[model samples]
Target: MTLSIDNLQQMEIEYIKMFSEVSEDEQTLTFNNSNIPDMYTHNFDLYKSDVGLLEYIESQINKVETKAKGFFRIETYHPISADLIEKLSVKPQICTYDFMGIETRNYINLIGNPECSVLSAESSRVLEDGITVDIAVNEEGMGLDFATRRIKGKAEVYKNPDKAIELFVCYSGDTPIGNIEYIPFNRVAKFEDFDILEDYQRRSFGTSVLKHLLEKAFDNNIEHAYLITDQADTAKEMYKKNGFEKVGEKTELLFLF
Candidate 1:
């Protein structure tokens, strides 16, 4: 299968549509997940950067803010122009996400730790231990207070049987050390929300979980697997080392009220 920027973008949109209430217009696609009011799950995704569409994006965001609490975000497939940036009332923190993909055929024999085991999570409730541990270890200051709301919101969408999503918890011995989400569509699989506890980092647990995900993809005859990571994140290097390559990038504009 040939990997292209268009294919990566479409795959991402399909993944979002799985759990989000998506509404499309000529200018943008609005994704609203009332279940999870997180910035990523709820946003206005512009098909292209156009100064004329700025007002419509702002109006939609305003509508979302009134119904859903917390921050609002806008994603652009193309880079925002100076005119669009300068017109915003509040200066937004712009973020760039690199879309990475790989042909699983090239890595069918990849290996990792034999002791690390990946198990499918039947429900989000079962992921609490791993989520709690991961948050407590990775986040600063914010602990269970943050985890509670996040888990509650995620639980709404995680358990939906209609979605092609699968949640997995990685265990080392009897301890839950990490977790990841897998979504496969039309022979293309997406891996997201991958995290390992601080104490579990540097060991082979993270790699083992990734290897397990790829092996699952291969078993299902999936030709490609992909993930999105912040441009500054170090994890992209690890992904590249395995089999993934940078295929494209998307820009996110975030506004906090």
Candidate 2:
């Protein structure tokens, strides 16, 4: 079987639906009023070019972002269309990023050479009450101190919110070190919200987190594991070495409000 732009767009939809509040009809995906630093949490997904795209952008600019900035992912089969860019010049902009969508289905021999031993995250425990993520990082370095504490405080908020998301935190004993979030849409696992304690980097934490997460995916009979990463050399090398092959690319439009 082959992947389509629609399938990947829905996965993008699933990504937003997991966190903040969203309402979608046929053409536009609206993430209404989520004040999270995470881009996925507060953004819109335009299926294709249409008048509705302009309307949605205008509406979001006035009612939503004001002078903040308009950052969004516009999923397309190929690179973005020039027609789309011309339509988006209504506002001043900063830059755009095209993410290479990577995937791996049938498991191959595990890939990668780590300087340290590879270890798996603890296990699948509920994000609500059963298991808690308590990764301890330098309060100043990566700002994990704020994010970790905030999410931990809002742990039960998911129950009242709309979607189901799986969050797994890795530990180096009683102290938590790293974590990953997987949102499964139709059999594809979308992995993001990854963080390792500042002091724990380059020590196989990333390798271990991804290894265990994919192992869980395989165990659950998942067909595809999808990742959207920047085109940076280091980011590409790390995931490529971990068996994630560059499959498709996603492009986004950026405008400075």
Best by lDDT: 1
After TM-score superposition, the amount by which residue 31's alpha carbon in candidate 2 deviates from its true location, in angstroms, is: 1.7
TM values, all candidates = 0.85, 0.67
Candidate with maximal TM-score: 1
Q: Which ten residues in a row have the lowest lDDT in candidate 2?
A: 112-121
Q: Candidate 1, residues 1-257: lDDT per residue as tens digits?
A: 77676677777788788667888877777787766555354445545544465785567557765436556677777767778879876567888999888887666556667789888888555567656655665467445655666655565567788778878888888888888889998788889888887777767788788888888898899988888999999877878777788888888887666
Q: Which run of 10 residues does model 1 get worst, by summed lDDT?
A: 41-50
State each model's CA lDDT, in order.
0.74, 0.55
Q: Name the TM-score of candidate 1.
A: 0.85
* Residue 185 shift from truth in candidate 1, angstroms: 0.8
Tell me each candidate's RMSD, in Å, in order: 3.0, 5.2
Show model 2 residue runs off by greater than 4 Å.
Answer: 33-40, 45-47, 50-78, 81-108, 111-154, 157-162
